[model samples]
Target: MERKMIRISGKRQITIPQKYFDLLGFDTEAECILRGNELVIRPVSERSGGEFAEAILADLISQGYQGDELLSKFKETQKKVRPAVKTMIDEADALAATGGSTASLDDLFGTEER
Candidate 1:
């Protein structure tokens, strides 16, 4: 690939040439990455989109997981776990409302209680 120079505008933005954009098939929301001394541009098609869902469904079918059973298991796990997390967050909020310092582990764990 031949190196091409792009002039920076007053706002410090450089427009990518149309040839490069066309060659890469980059659409409006394409992502670019800068790694050390190299620049990498990636189109959305090269990324993992709904393909993960397809892969997961294939794996679940291969493992003999029925749709309703899988959903029920997920719901059961969420119901069991959410209450503990909510209680912890509520306790933290109560402590925060007391205007207590939370800057250190000792303060948070009540080690400095007078």
Candidate 2:
């Protein structure tokens, strides 16, 4: 196809010709890509409509697959682990609550008093 010349305005804006727009199915929301040395403009497809970051986040969300179910499962796992963690925390708190009186360096070293 023969390409037509377009004039860049003072504001550095190029007016895309109606013919090219119609041929390429370009709309007001179309995206333009400028590679190393090529300028390509095309209509955004459903599969590629969003910004790259949005697309990546969307893909990550989609891959999560279980949505609320996964969240519920995680909560369930936390519930199962909570008691053990709490027990450990309680033990540590009790140890700390001793005020270090029973935590002698000899006790730590498992040795008799010199």
Candidate 3:
């Protein structure tokens, strides 16, 4: 882990080290996350909400969505992906902290050898 003490400006803005910025592919925007007691600042993924675009569109189209309605619903569903993922991560972390086991494939998708 590379560690460097940086001075926060009067406006509370801190500059990212050039090495770290280039290494992490920092762009014009970043995502700030607070996990436990640590604050994490990472590059905003260009693929965020985009990876699921095809799947979301397929499902919506299969439901007979078209025209502006399809576009609107696609945008709406895409917006929910990030929040849903964050919730799952938080739940998983809580479960791990409590030493709780997560569901198996059989529990989630059912067993084929019924």
Instruction: Point out where model 3 deviates above 4 Å.
Output: 1-15, 19-23, 27-41, 46-48, 102-114
In candidate 2, which residue pairs get closer than 3 Å at backbone N, Cα or C atoms, i.e. clash?
Answer: none
21-43 per-residue lDDT for model 1 (tens digits):
89979887666778999977677
lDDT of each: 0.62, 0.60, 0.84
lDDT of 3 by residue, 1-114 (tens): 779999999999999999999999999999998999998999998765888899999999999999999999999999988887676677666666776577664443345531
- Winning candidate number (TM-score): 3
Q: How well is each residue in 1-114 modelled by candidate 2, as lDDT tens digits?
A: 777899999998888799887887876667777788998877865432223434334444575736776556444444444455446556655667777557754443335422
lDDT of model 1 at residue 23? 90
Instruction: List TM-score per model, in order.
Output: 0.43, 0.38, 0.61
- Candidate 2 Cα misplacement greater than 4 A, ranges: 47-114
What's the distance in Å from true for residue 70, model 1? 11
Q: Which candidate number would show the highest lDDT if scored against the true structure?
A: 3
